[model samples]
Target: MKKFRKIGVAAVGVLTLTALVSGCGTANTTNSTPSSSAPVPTGNAGTTGKLEIFSWWTGVASSKALKALIHVFNEKYPHVQVINEAVAGGAGSNAHAVLASRMTNNNPPGTFQVHAGNGSLYSWVQAGDLDSLNNLYQSQGWLNKYPKSLLNLITFNGNIYAVPVDMQRANVLWYNPSIFKKYNLTPPTTFSQFFQDAKVLKAHGITPLALANHGNWETTLLFSDVLLGTVGYTDYNKLLHGQMSWNSPGVVQAANTFTKMMQYTNSDASALHWQQADQLVANGQAAMNVMGDWAQGYFKTTLNLTPGKDFGWAPTPGTQGVFSVVSDVFALPSKLSASQKAVALNFLKVLGSAEGQKVFNPLKGTFSPRLDANPSDYDAYSQAAMKSYQKDQLTLCIGQGAVNPGFTTAFENAMAIFVTNHNTKQFIQSIENAAQTNPLS
Candidate 1:
């Protein structure tokens, strides 16, 4: 087994780059341990050996999409070894624990995954744990490529920390066309209409929304969108920022509204994973699923469904229309050799490339963070999502993207409790508690 340990710098003021070990064969799995027995490895990867990377992308379709990106990365850098430390379990748990421990001990992966948002990145940047990439961003002009909403979130204090990998779109409704036809139902355009349609499906003995409650992310996704549907984006931000409490009517009403929607989900939903819920909709056993755009990758790879021809995708209706989005971005550590920094920057540039956008997002079943990137190249679901996104006027999906992960856990637990115990008031209170209690960057 490869040994791992954490190393701390003797010098307090200098920026310390986190360490990653090398020489794991191609079959390496996630061993979150940061070993002290070895020197922090570095080299001209493309001219030499592998570039070990870590991320939470162990799902079949997602892993496949990731491999495709790696293949693209290899095409131009054939000599570089790309070892994937993709781990599964705990709904990003394995990676989270490893990274948190790493950052705490001042050890970070050469490349690890993290969400780009105000509340997540600011502290790390201030601690000298992250590297600055203003020159790279200025050179590539990421401000022009990535949407202002996303770019703004990645900028902490003033510096960009991460290389955005993909845009994770929320508020998508993936429904079986055959099931819709059988029920004589059309996709809803309003909350009232959606409930009425749910009744129509339930009356005919169908689960209106296929969901998996075990992983809190799913519940949180809906929770974020519900706030949007009930209150609109501006007010949701106010509530999130502590300008208003959950007792405020909008938060309470959103919880109450979600309480109603919970009735139409599958009875066994609490036992299922998000992928299993995707399967339920795919098999036509359930009528719809409200998940991120990545859900399309599952439908494409598992059920082999073609978008539009066999199924359809749309955003949930809101009083004021907008897209709720999450993003995955990569942050580089400091003190790298000039060549290594160049390679990292080059890789980031490619990730934003038009070809990269076309190949990666479609395979990942996600949206490109780039506004000017072409959407016509993606699957039907993404195409429709992009269309709605362009027209709806974009807004941050706080529950998924803006909320701190620590608080997200709180809200998810509150949602589960609310769903099981029928406690809408407590649900509202829990969100308020998070804003007040949890550590926001």
Candidate 2:
């Protein structure tokens, strides 16, 4: 784990160098035990102060959902001015660079959104830049509120560092219903079926898969889905944890499958971001897209398309029984003053509460991290997703910080090259090289 610290520092240093060289354009890169339930101190509620939150969810659905959550928080703590310092970028690419700079300069935000996994939390913990929420969890009774499996991912060295607000299934295959019907195609449940549908769609002049490689992380995300679908959840987890070799036959097969899938994507994929790729599907230019469930929000809210009617969804091929988890959480930085800590913890309390989750997840196109969130509040897609989540084997989304940030970036770089070259051997070797530098062991 100490190696993870070096990886974090080195990655931040690289970002600093890039910013210095390139003039800092929207740069892209990519805790604790708690006590029993207790009353939160509100002596400072009358004091007026600002709470700055940093995140990359500046899109319509995410931004709207966040604002709703903030509105609820503001109602209770009216004196505290909540400043949303959201950076616009796909998968925290730009926001991360800004955060790294802020942390490096000793000017961290009150609390910022982070992935609830080893990749994100471990790096900060290793750097000694984050405070634990063990006591907070104990006080809030959240130890038992969330799933033990989920709690395990956020917990490190017996401390809970962040409060998970929502969970997004990353292995979702979303498609235009009209497009599928026009071609007489059913939603694919197997890779063979996917290839078959892709052939049909291509012959009819439709892009089989909508992919965006502009952010680089989108490509890695697509690869993660393909890898999971090809290798299955167990081996995929093994690969992510370094228990399985990157050069293994399963990984090689997954890489080959990824290459094959890339063939069906739009030629302009490299020019677009994830949202643009999704638009290809939404507007009926493409047949399908593999993305997190957040696309559901974009379709419903931004595009005004109804789920199960305008669009449809299914688990990615060979992943019907698996749930690829990408949870969004908020963590407190260690540099907060006593007053800031109190306000930050209060904000986290709302974020972790069932009330806050119910208000946020439905609008965000995701399910709540809390097990007890009412299913009636969500839409048809989220309701089905929540049901699947209850029974499916859960796996971490490596592209979304389930591993290590340095390794994630390395894998994304390899994927970026693979997208253009389609060189399987080089892709596999690049992954192996990345694993060597940041061993999961």
RMSD of each: 10.8, 9.5
RMSD of 2: 9.5
List runs of model 2 lying over 4 Å from the truth: 1-47
- Candidate 1 residue-wise lDDT, 1-441, digit = tens: 221111112211211122111211011122222211111123453344545566788887778878888778788777776788776865665677777687687555556676665444544555566676665666655545654445555654344567787877777777888988877888876789889989988888889989897776678778788787788766765565556667888877888888889989988877888889988887878888888777888878766888786778777756335666577777665544544554555566566676666777787778776666676677667777766655554455655435566676787778778878978767777877876787442
Q: Give the distance in Å from residue 195's predicted Cα in candidate 2 to where it truly belongs.
A: 0.9
Rate residue 270 of model 2 by lDDT. 81
Model 2 whole-model lDDT (C-alpha atoms): 0.80
75 Cα displacement, candidate 2 (Å) = 0.5
Tens digit per residue, CA lDDT, model 2, 1-441: 100111111133212222222321111122333322223446664245789988988989999999999988998889899999999876787888899899999999989988877787678767777887876776777755665556666665555678999989999999999999988999999889999999999998999999888888887887888888888877787788778889999889888888888889889988897888889998889999998998988898888988899989999898888888889999888887767877888888889999999998888888896767788988899999988776677777778877788899899888888888989899999999999898765
Please state the error at residue 115 of candidate 2 in Å. Answer: 0.5
Q: Which predicted model would earn the best lDDT?
A: 2
Scored against the true structure, residue 57 in model 1 reaches a CA lDDT of 86
TM-score of each: 0.84, 0.90
